[model samples]
Target: MLLPMSIQAKSYGWGFKKNTNHQPPDVGVYKNILDDLGGYYLDNSGDKVVYLTFDNGYEEGYTGKVLDVLKEKKVPATFFVTGHYVEDQEQLVKRMVNEGHIVGNHSYHHPDFTKLSKAKMKEELESLEEAVAKITDQKEMQYVRPPRGTFNKQSIQWANELGYTHVFWSLAFVDWNTDSQKGWKKAYQQVMDQIHPGAVILLHTVSKDNAEALAYMIDDLRKQGYSFRSLDDLVMKDILPEPIIGF
Candidate 1:
């Protein structure tokens, strides 16, 4: 049995205990809070649908490969990007939008929303949305991945009021430290071992291993009977009740 978790309005660095049992992570009260706020980390449809998301702060030359793999595999993904990435890689950002992928906001300067005022949080999101809008066909950004996975109840509430949905991850690993990458196999195994139905998988575009393992991972996950979904699909599925869908 799981114990009830108490939530506070204070700043929180988002994290949860990973389960070897390959289940949706135990996010305690965080999940409930997000659920009520129209934010989500897991698909509630109880189906074998997986949403792939990537955090691109500043590219390390592997995003193109990742994009190529996604294109080849015909998988849809959401790329949450920072202002620095947009300023640095406008073409890549355009490509992400042009190739039928959703580009999400990771904030303009990549600051902790929990530390910013409501106005400033809106500014951060709107600024990134504007930057992305300038370079792509996406005129609006609807999802946000808080910088460094940090947020508070108030921060999330502000994002909600600002028309952005907070997107946290149910599956992730230490693939961000560019200096400590193990290998493609390790990345593949880590994801395979942790994947679950309705999971929102977070991968960093800076990870070379992730760039290399993405294709294989897609194939294997498809073989496991999992379907790839976009964040738009995830949110739409959520908005429409389970029974009402496909009726």
Candidate 2:
């Protein structure tokens, strides 16, 4: 099946949207392309499962607390850490692995991967993989979330060739700006209001608001019959048809 030009155009600048109705629009276009290319944006499991992920570019002061909450709740999450985070906080990264959390590659420098050449992109992934392997002793890092939520078809295909499953979120908010945090109540509402089945919720460990509201959010999500899953569990395998070359 040939991809529509409109879908291809949209893929270059696709950003996640928070659906109030909890129904993401015509993602088949995106999903079909990703499934064939070994990438993923949303999980359409139709079950009450939320894949919790955090983008840890660099630790602020809250990742430990965030990890503590996840530990208390016994919820598994994927933490996509940059090369700097791994280098600076080796123990924390080790703790994440020891605690049974999946550590994903967020690239070495956190550059907009859509802008890099295939070689540079591979370096971004490989350097992080080497660092993570040295720290966690887990040689195979299967998941990656592109920096700034920006990716193109070519970038996805390159990542696929490198044996990565690109992970994009189905739910996210403006929580990266620490100074702009509205409060825990507002954060809670922002997440709960858009909560849906099979939501890949993106949170930043840098946000104090997220640290404050995460436990409450977990409780509420469970009350609404949603359970958290790691990216390892949510990733689909053998679902893609033969690779469509030259995207």
Go through the candidates in order and give each one's C-alpha lDDT: 0.87, 0.82
For each candidate in turn, the TM-score is: 0.93, 0.88
Give the residue spans of candidate 1 off by over 4 A. 1-9, 241-247
lDDT of 1 by residue, 1-247 (tens): 2212233346677889987786788998787777766688888667888899999999899999999998888889999999999999999999999999999989999997877878898888898999998878999989999999998777877787888889999999999999999999999999999999889999999999999999999999989888888887777774666532210
**Listing every candidate in turn, what is its Cα RMSD in Å to the true structure after a full C-alpha superposition?**
4.3, 5.9
Top lDDT hit: 1
The candidate 2 region of ten consecutive residues with least summed lDDT is: 238-247
Total colliding residue pairs, candidate 2? 0
RMSD of model 1 against the true structure: 4.3
Q: Local error of candidate 2 at 120, Å?
A: 1.3
Best of the candidates, TM-score? 1
Cα lDDT of model 2 by residue, 1-247, tens digit:
3445554444354565457886653454566667767666666757687888999998888999999999999999999999999999999999999998899989999998867878999999999999999978677899989888777677787787789888887888889998898888888888988888878888999999999999999998888887777776665423453321110
